[model samples]
Target: MRAVPRPAILGSIAAVLFLACVAPEDRGTDATNLRDPWAIRAEPGDPALAAGKEIFASCASCHLADAGGRSDGTIPRLAGQRAEILEWRLRGLQDGSIDLPVMTPFARALTEAEIRQVSAYLASLPRPERIGSASGGVNERGAKLYHDRCRSCHSAEADAVAASNAPRLCGQHEAYLLRRLEDMASGNAGGAGAARAVDPAMEAIAIALSMEDRLRVSRYLARSECD
Candidate 1:
């Protein structure tokens, strides 16, 4: 048998000792941390907001001048979204966890500070009125589904709990919401690193819902009002 070098043997022992010293939470290989540093509020009159508005000019082409997005449900409204959620999504796009062809490039273009600034700016805007055509029928089934499964994280109150990661869904376009549900169910909503942005529980729920149930839930959220 070939003999191991003395230096190599010592190096292996040193490496093992170093790993043992690492804290449990700090030793994990997962790169995605949900409690991120970027999810912070920018107060009114903050310089970040001003710079963000200028930077948002590029986004206006697709999201519209007011960030209301397209009424046809091709785009999603950004106005009044939670700043934390916006920042998280932007970071996910930049890191390749959440991959949207149209959005990834835009997200990658921004620096860390720019991501925070733009998120705060978008969150400050007034949420637009319901922007698309509604299904215009009874949504009791959808409401029940939401109440049973979704309300805990996505509260229906005017002011949802800020600490939760869930984004507000009321008044979102039905088609867009439905498509997202489909994507989540099929495990196509995000990229390889999607575990950071896409909750396993959410994916399970989406998979459990039938096609018609998904549509009904989407319709219910689309017409629902929020503060």
Candidate 2:
């Protein structure tokens, strides 16, 4: 992990404590609309950016201070994500459209302004180097599976994450990818309470793969280069 300045880190921690003391009314309303993520563009060092960094202290535990997330893929890299995508996903989580175990409630805790601010902060950071495969080496079977099943959307170069509005697979952690695939394949990847177009699309794709294929593809992606 990259070393961060102690003061900045401490300030972020303090912000978390401050947010805790804020009453429900002071916390502001939950984010409900994702259609206008660019409603506020906060540059680094701006007041919005500063506030966002402070509020993000609570998230650092899981996402890491640099937002590099875990190399094992249990969490995703938040750094370098598009602000629009972050806003959209957070809104979905806040409203229960996306039903992650921890993120659901975590999203609920933030006000709309804080969410946009943090999203801006995350988008400002540089993307990390590829995490590489947990399996130690590329598996040909996995590569083949990706070519046939995933390449259309992810692209052969695997650099179309933002263009496709899909998650970054290249440089992602294998274990995390594996677990998510398992969940999607098993029809347990969230939105269990109601139907949503996004949830079903992924599930349909995952359902076509056997467990072995899923493992192979995930490992292949974990080791693949983004360029």
Candidate 3:
């Protein structure tokens, strides 16, 4: 047997020790991939999601390596969310119907195939925990508020009416929907209604909501209802 250099022998021993102590997923990353201080291990591969993985490259830039959203809440969550809903939103984006400036570029940049790929990947990821199921949470006042103020423009299509560009509210997360409502109340959601800033009625809807009233209404909307 040949004698190994002492320093080389010690280095090899150290490398083996590190691997033994490391988790399986932490191997094989390069420096660029390591740029994000928050990189993490994703769940085990789902053979079905292989397609989405390839398509999601564009979105991974903003949504992050993990489906988890950013701290500022600027981007909506896509992971673990309903696939159909995500597809519809993407379709809206691709078709140039949704208004937010930030999203316009993303929609325009992605191809139909790419959209399907990314949307599929996002759908396969897990949903946010804040999206809890609706139970005993209906409030008559909120329902009436939705009907009287919101229904004219929003129309009646499940919890949310997307036909009039009102957006379907069914299956939306309680916390997310509520946060949106709060934003609307405080001049935050930006668009008024339908055609993005054309509906003045949305202001009335926002005004009707007192802090508690808005909350109750939000909870009622969260209480899963049939379209």
Pick by TM-score: 1 or 2, better one: 1
Clashes of each: 0, 0, 6
Model 3 misplaced stretches (Cα beyond 4 Å):
1-50, 53-99, 117-137, 152-162, 190-199
Model 3, 1-227: lDDT tens digits are 13222222111111111001111122332334322211112234744367567555544566555554433434334454434334445554444443445444545555666455554566556545444344355778867766665555444533323223233344444455556556656665544322332233554566667877666655565564432
Q: State the TM-score for model 2.
A: 0.68
TM-score winner, 1 or 3: 1
Question: Candidate 1 on 33-74: residue-level lDDT in tens?
Answer: 444433446677889988778767665766777777655656
Candidate 1 vs candidate 2, lDDT winner: 1
The TM-score leader among the candidates is: 1
Off by over 4 Å in 2: 1-42, 99-109, 130-133, 160-164, 194-197
Worst 10 residues of 2 by lDDT: 15-24
The positional error of residue 132 in candidate 2, measured at the CA in angstroms, is: 4.6
- Please list the C-alpha lDDT of all candidates, in the order they appear: 0.60, 0.58, 0.44
**lDDT per residue as tens, model 2, 1-227:** 23333233322221111001111122233334223433348765788888767767766777778877676655665566557656655665566544453444556666788667877887677667646436757799999888887777666855433333454457666777787777667765533542231435556778998998888888888788765
Best of the candidates, lDDT: 1
> Which residue pairs collide in model 1, if any?
none
Q: How much RMSD separates candidate 1 from the native structure?
A: 14.0
